[model samples]
Target: MDRTPSFLQQHKQTFQRVGAVLLAILVWQVLAMAVGHQLLVPSPLSVLERLAGIWLEAGFWSTVWFTFRKIVAGFLLGLALGLGLGSLAGRFPLFEILFRPWAVMVKSVPVASFIVICLIWMSSARLSIFISFLMVLPIVYTNVLQSIRSVDRQMLEAVQIFRLPWAKRVLYLWLPQMKPYLISACSVGLGISWKAGIAAEIIGIPSGSIGQMFYDAKVYFNTTDLFTWTIIVVVVSVLFEKGFLALLKWLYGRLEKL
Candidate 1:
């Protein structure tokens, strides 16, 4: 086997990605200078400086913590419901028929409309959690149900013929098959959850939340602050996705090994 350096082999793409980000930032900085109005477009350096300041503020961490908890709770709730409902629907035609309409309605209805209506029943503080849950549920349900349905009939038949134990079927068949669909659902779901959650907060303007700060930034035309907060959201969303996917991939590897 060739003994190449791990960082060189594994992180060449990482270096390329970092270069791309730097290029984008350079372009943004140039555009900001061309605009010549700080309110309209703050330079990249100004935004970075603002972000650094926010990182040091005690209130920033509190806001982040609150938002993180709400969004993550919503995501977990949606995932659980999706798994439970998807399994039922996949196993039984009746369940599929019963659940598909609701899922379709959730998918078809505009998220804004849901936010408006939900606000009436729930406090603004809880808006993000509910909206996140609603947005993520359909995607998860569809992916999982499809994964269940897409199991190769021939392989299933072979397993049945072989009279394999349920544990073996799960280990060799179901786990392998569900891995991709689960990862895909989660990857998509988590991103959307953060987006929807933040949007909900922005609309609701819950006090002391990042959304409130974002709204303040917009209201006051604080372009640098807006850019800084936007960067924070993007960073948090990306980190959450990467961390969650890493956990999912690790679990998958462990399951496969078993």
Candidate 2:
């Protein structure tokens, strides 16, 4: 029998990640000290101080919610459409051909180009949603379709031979096969969605958005505020990814049990 890992071994990866982040912060602090100019480089301490008090800033929560809701909405819309269309495409070659051109165009076009084009058609308030959706759609679609296509022929035949009900087939066969790919796609898609959505907000300068905060930080040349907001964005994005992936895994577990 294989030996189980010790507690330290089990948590080694987490400890390493924490150490890496601490080392990066130490380096940043050293760099700021060497620069000796607050405007040029605010120390990590100053950024943390700003972060501690940022919640009290006027419109802070509202601004965060404004960006958060739109970006999350876009991600959800993309997830739904990608799964629906990808499933159809996997089942029918004609559907694949039908969607191929649009997928190729979306994947090929630069995000900045899309932002410019979208600005011509829509207001800044909705820009982040569209960009986030566009960023996520192809990624999820490709992963889902590939997962479906990669299913084992022998396993599929066994299901057919057993005359398993549709629900059972999905629970026992499809879900297991698609789980890893879907998780991976969502992980990648979430990160891309945040990046694209934030970029859209910055360009469009949507009022009361995180992008607006960033733009203001840049315009005023407040390095501490800028660093503080950057840290907030990173923390929020990481938390969002972790929570979403955990939920997705939990959902999979519940479904598998059913």
Worst 10 residues of 1 by lDDT: 2-11
Q: Model 1, range 1-258, lDDT digits (tens) per residue?
A: 978888877899999999999999999989999998899999998887887788898788999988989999999999999988887898898999999789999999988899889989999999999999999899889998999899999999999999999889878988788889999999999999999999999998888888998899999999899888888989998999999999999998898676
Question: Per-residue alpha-carbon lDDT of model 2 for 119-182, expressed as tens digits?
Answer: 9999999999999999999998998899899999999999999999998987899878989989
* Local lDDT at 232 for model 2: 80
TM-score of each: 0.91, 0.92
Off by over 4 Å in 1: 1-12, 162-168
Best by TM-score: 2
